[model samples]
Target: MPSVLKTQPWNVHRLPAAEGKRFLVTGGNAGIGYFVAEQLAGTGATVVLGSRDAAKAEAAIASIRSRVPGAKVQHLRLDLADLASLKTSVDALGPDRLDAVVYNAGVALDHPPRRETKDGHELMFATNHLGHFALTGWLAPLLVATPGSRIITTGSFAAKSERLDFDDLQNTHDYRPKRTYGRSKLAQMLFSFELDRRLRAAGSTTLSVVVHPGGALDSLTPSRPQVRVRTTGERLRGLPLGLLVQGKEAGAWPAVRAVLDPDVRGGHLWGPRVFGLRGRPGLAPIWDHLADTTTAARLWAASCDLTGVAPTFTPV
Candidate 1:
């Protein structure tokens, strides 16, 4: 594995995103999301911070305004755990189109047993994949309407642990929190790749990209109330192993690179250079199986059926 510090650093400061573009970033309150939102705001783009918590989103916006001095930042309530919230947010987002939508919100369930969201999907699957899946589907028109629009989904290196379990998509039969989380992240990457393929096939110009922050101990993985006990146990295990994790800022870089770098190609993966785990941002190779046409087509159909929202705009 390349060390996290050895990779080439991404100079996001050189990005010219301030030229009257609009962006929507989920979980923009703190950690990597905060940094991504802050940097974009600094560039003078109209940034919409998406959060389940209204207060946190507002505070995040305030913090960005303070840093950027006239940074155009706003907040919208979006609870990835609830399909109703997703619908409301999409409806309430109004007709204003977006230049990009960054799916940065995620959760890590370290709790015992397992839980499901209001949508009857596993919590990890619901929040990390389905919610974002539905949101992006709903906003496809807005994204497609804007020229050069991009959709960036936050994935994780942990995804390497497992492949999608189609038989048990919700983990109701066999539930392991970590494995479930990995499956969700893997689904996210697959979704991005599949979406890109669909868009291209339809002749759409929009871009869909996926990125993973090496190993930043950021809020991307929040301890749910039910999972706190497991987290404590894991922390104890880590103490003896002496694992060195990078900060959230380092994790935020890959996603930032995916969003701001004009050279970033659709379906490319980005991560830190060292062992591809930590350091500066660079394009990383994706697993070949992820690009399988059959898999991508099937998943897209499954998403549409599950979400009950067919994509309105075909890529062209």
Candidate 2:
């Protein structure tokens, strides 16, 4: 690790200007994704909220405009679960070059009988991993055409201890909601690293970086009435938890930094500085499981087979 990466002071409030650049954030209507979009919009870049619901996206856009005053933001109908609609959704992304796409959207089932998407895949796996896998493939042309474009994957700390069961990738046999969700996220992170390797091998300038929000809590998040309304009591109760966890806004820092920081490189994992839980965004060490190239390659093949989309990179 470079000493600069360790010592550089990154002021989350003072973001670099990104005028004329365009970014797409999946599930940008809520949680950390919403904050990611809001922060990027503050950079004077056009921000598109890729979501499945129009009403939620509109509310998020309105909230951003209210805060940033003239923030260029819009909604793009994107349903990650619906792999069939991904190509059409990319088409709707317009003909303009995309500077970055943040894979932040995810579905975590709290209590489940193990749901499946219309595509006949596990719901969590479909939405969190396969969806972005396919979307990246569809967006390859636009991304490859744009100089120095980025694909940022928002992984999870929950995935730290989990490992992908290649035999039961979809959790068809035994599905524990939380464990399965962690595996799905682990799969996504591995894909990002594998994608970076592929991009480098293809001699592409497009970078694929992975980041994870330490621990984000709605109670700790600031109130954005149009999107999220955190009650006074909730804030008071969450104050104690702030010692270890953080608000969604702070949680957005890693991904935001991954997008705007010129120093960020492909195949690196960035996260919170304090115990990988809360604090300023910084370069975090990649987990041992994440470095297993064999596992990543297997996941890539499985993803391509499942989503029917294989991304190919070329130098810009």
Candidate 3:
């Protein structure tokens, strides 16, 4: 191997077939999650898709199979918006070993009239951060048991300017949809990095990585009738998509690299190389504000308290 390879991440061109490995993805029914599952399946890995919609999950599986003949794919119904549903989904997964997990499901856009989930959490907060928090806790044992396993959590550029609103985590008082969404993504990054730190402190082998699929727009994403159904507005938006935003297929590269890149270490955060919004995946910079141990610990404690899911690691 070259000397540089030992110090830097590798660019993925031809992913070595991951035969006998097992991977799971959240929101695998559509968009970037569907693409993530598809690419992993293409590499000979058995994939379990966690989705809320059965029909959509089935369609995604069918779509994967069409491209990769005899792809080993299964669906586990997981509702990221519901804590009970998340618990049920984890129970269905059993205590089996998994090679990796991609926390790909998230609410990327702002919703009108902010609402709370059945768990009484802000809708975006619940689905984007809370659900993943609980799910990871439920599956931590299996993850730690499997040597070299990795966890990749998706984040966003909007998080670059976000600071967690601990006082109003649910945005109950000043409920701005876009700001709430940004905080949620920031929370994911905080959780993932803290998880990595804890894993290392406990001398665990499993790694936690954070990545963002920069600007994955609906107009640029592939049209799959069974999975993604773009409307008239979305079609119209496609006219200018090529000029700015890259396709979702390209967008998924950062995440895929985060999971399978041999050079990635625990706590590593990766994103696009150019403008932090487009081009090939690379190790990008993150705001130093996110590195505050005090804030991270506070968020970690609050997450456990709210979701009732405790991590399996101890502090160093």
Candidate 4:
């Protein structure tokens, strides 16, 4: 039987089929990242799954191949917490053009205390925001070459209560893990929106968009032996939470919309339709922080200074 939901607005299948297109998805080894790759690759896009783990990345490739028979998928060695790894991935994409890049990889929910990246920054800030800021800057040349190519930064509901802390970019003092994570996500939204503004000012054709997956849980994500193996506790909590929360497959829709929807304008946020949590994808209402251009510019300036990469986008 044909799926019933396709007729409804926000159906994942409604997105046009993609062929001869290439996409890069960071953190594609697991969770919503993996599902985003799967959905895009299933439509015949060459999906590069980027993660720090070679073995797990290969496993994700295998999973995509299995589920989407003839899926064009590949592995990209990427460590969100490291810059050398970004260099490696950039070299891999040398001269190869991409249709879009989804900055979906991030550290979330669990970690050691006061931990930092090899670059000597807070792990959450370094991994979630800094790494993507660097990656986007590095890829600006390639992104500009492709017509209508987009850079999609994943935002979070956590950003609602967060504010920029310029005095402490690393979040070293009074650092609560959850709040720190939230602030990093806030940084992402700020960066994407600011990027679109700069692209416009510079007359660049590369688009920048932000989408947030509300409360997507890895526990509800299915187990893939080499990629993501759910724990017994995750299985227990996942099944119950699955009732109220979305699995990774459902969680990926908003991002897919941002990538494939020609009508979607840059700088507008997209989220799940119902309460920004669990439901079909829809246009997200703007929050006060989202509209604050001053704050967005501040965060963008800080990112460039900290990452030490200046992106020069020549107008198309």
**lDDT scores of the candidates, listed in order:** 0.77, 0.94, 0.83, 0.82
Q: State how far residue 91 of model 2 sits from its true place (Å).
A: 0.5
lDDT of 1 at 123: 87
**Per-residue C-alpha lDDT of model 2 across residues 152-238, encoded as one tens digit per residue:** 999997898999998899999978999999999999999999999999999999999999999999999999999989999999999
**Best-first order by lDDT:** 2, 3, 4, 1
For every model shown, the clashing-pair count is: 10, 0, 0, 0
lDDT of model number 2:
0.94
Residue ranges of candidate 1 with Cα displaced over 4 Å: 1-10, 218-245
Error of 3 at 100 (Å): 0.7
Please give, for residues 223-259, the per-residue lDDT of candidate 1 as tens digits.
3232112265565554532244555656777777777
How well is each residue in 164-214 modelled by candidate 4, as lDDT tens digits?
Answer: 888876778887888889999999888888888899888887888888887
Model 1, C-alpha of 221: deviation from truth (Å): 14
Specify the poorest-scoring 10-residue window by lDDT in model 1. Answer: 221-230
- Specify the highest-TM-score model's number: 2
Better of 2 and 4 by lDDT: 2
User: Which candidate number maximizes lDDT?
Assistant: 2
Runs in model 3 deviating more than 4 A are 1-13, 108-111, 229-240, 314-316
- How do all models score by TM-score? 0.86, 0.98, 0.92, 0.91
Predicted structure 1: lDDT: 0.77
